[model samples]
Target: MSIMRRFSFNHATAKFWDQREAVEACARTGSGIGLWREPVQEMGLEASAKLVKDAGVQVTSLCRAGFFTDPTQAAIDDNRKAIDEAAELGAPTLVLVSGGIPEGGTIDSAREGVKEALSVLAPYAGERGVTLSIEPLHPMFASDRCVVTTINEALDLAAPFPAGQVGVVVDTYHIWWDPQVWQGIARAGREGRIASFQFADWVTPLPAGVLTGRGQLGDGCVDFKRYLAEVDATGFTGPIEVELFNDALWARPGAEVFEETRAAFARVLE
Candidate 1:
């Protein structure tokens, strides 16, 4: 049997493609995918599930499930549904973005919210055999996008959960600039908590919204090979998913972006 290469595409980049088309694109490239809930929901979960099954492509993860820093019971309940969707689609993990500070809230309060949210959802994720991967967005988004802004912060959040239930997503884009990153990666590996490793190049003067400005692999400051080597040393073998949220990439034809992304991913890792 041929060894599968280490690469996965984030469905968000294929914003133009309908659900089935996105799955087919991954299938044609013999690649895996990271799916987002909005598109999956719009396309119907069952329909998306069937398409991935038929196409024989792996759903590496479900893009998100956590955005309730002032987490109410309702937010916890919603994450359960996200877990169910991931299970139905055979996604091994659910990517979680610890939500931003609530109104009249401090960052400390938001951290408490993350703990509360995870406390409610982690057990449920474990029951379903789905790993919850907490992704720490860049500090630039600490106020509005995600509270967990460093791998250390994510690890701290995941530490309480058993390895099977919760782990940290070490996305290079968010953490490449962190001075304490090396220790964080090593500690995550030591604890067996390296859940879903991702890739995105780092560009300067981050774009507004701080969400859509992710650079294509090799187009920015990230040392891709260094990250690969570090993660590889951890003995955690998983797809290094390319998850660029760039508007320019999103505007291009899916096929064109896919081909370019695949090439960039390979080139950077090489």
Candidate 2:
């Protein structure tokens, strides 16, 4: 099969585009989609589910539902809702970004809070046929975006739970800098913890700020083929979502950006 057969487009790549239009494009190419919560909620869960189902588009994963550094009841409730939404959409994985350091708390304390939150949601997710995917952001995002910033850290957090109940997301943009990433990938594969695999290149920002400058493939320093080889070696054959967040891409028409992204992905895999 073509490597593009497993390609998935993340909605955040075109944050302002219409979800229906995006779904139509994915369906035409047999591509999958990584959906975010706000858009899904805006379109209404049932309507979004119906749209994808009717289009024969696969919902690869949900964008996120984890911000429980404090493990507040509110956070738990919201995540429960997200799990239900994933189930409703036929998304097997619910990506999670453990919230950053809480007020007056150290990174260590913040992580403990994530543990507490997971304890509450893991079983709930498992029962609903959803996997909570722990996505560790880069260390630069530690203070405000996510405290979990490494594959080892994400894997460690998932260890106590059943692999099916909780797993790690191997996102290139986040874990590419880890010296032991290969070993981490192998370990995650051995333990059945790689629930989601995503791609984005690291590039110097063009005044679009760091977070919004996830480079288009081949524009920056990521070696897509190597990442692909390592992941394939791990026996992971899931959708490889191209989740770029470039301000330039987002400014273009959704269909134009969609085609460009697909071509870029095809080039990288070639």
Candidate 3:
């Protein structure tokens, strides 16, 4: 497939962009979208689903569900709800950020929590036709965002489940620095576990918030073309979602953000 044909704009890239407008823009561009739960809820599940469906926009994946570091019944329940939401929206994958170390818990213990939670939810997700995609954030986020810090670790967590039930997301912003990223991608492909693939550049001197540190395509050190070739070599031809977060970008108009992001993506990959 053509690169632009596989392009997807994640709503969080322009944090405050109106959902309908974003989806419409994606439709016009023949792109896909990665949707978040809050905006979907605010837009009402039915309405949000209709908006994408009417526009003929593909819902690439749901932003998140996990945070099951403790694996409490409540956490499991909430993730189940997220899975349901993903099903309703026709999202094939539900990205999971295993929450940080819980109170009185160590990182290792938190990882155990993720394993147990997946055992419970993976089957449910499989039954509903949604893949629970484990996302290993940069180690800086290990304590509070996700205990899984490497693609290998995430793969280990997903090992027990069928590829259709659980998989890993390869988000460049998070895993680009991993020494074994290429191996992990090849392994994921061999196992059919590449549930979702996302792009975001890693600019140096991260912002104070850290979370808003993602750079626009071509603005940083990440090699987007190389990443594309790596995944393509894995025989995966899925949508490549551009998910960047910048406070300044968020502060601007959404339509402008779309144009800038579009140009930036082409510059970086084409």
Best by lDDT: 2
Error of 3 at 206 (Å): 1.9
Q: Can you write out model 1's per-residue Cα lDDT over 1-270, one digit (the tens) per residue?
A: 222366888887656666677778889889999999999898899988998999999999998889989888888888999999999999999999888889999999999999988888899999999999999888878999798999888998988989999999999989998999988999999999998999989887777746888888888899988898899898988887888888888778888888888888877765
- Lowest lDDT sum, 10 consecutive residues, model 3, at 1-10
Query: Model 2 — TM-score against the truth?
Result: 0.98
- Runs in model 1 with CA error above 4 Å? 1-4
Q: TM-score of each candidate?
A: 0.96, 0.98, 0.98
Native-vs-model 2 lDDT?
0.93
Runs in model 3 deviating more than 4 A are: none
68, model 2: CA deviation in Å? 0.6
Q: Write the per-residue lDDT of candidate 3 for residues 30-149, one digit (tens) a residue.
A: 989999999999999999999999999999999978899999999999999999999999999999999999999998899999999999999999999999999989999999989999
Per-prediction backbone clash count = 0, 0, 0
* lDDT for position 160 in model 2: 89
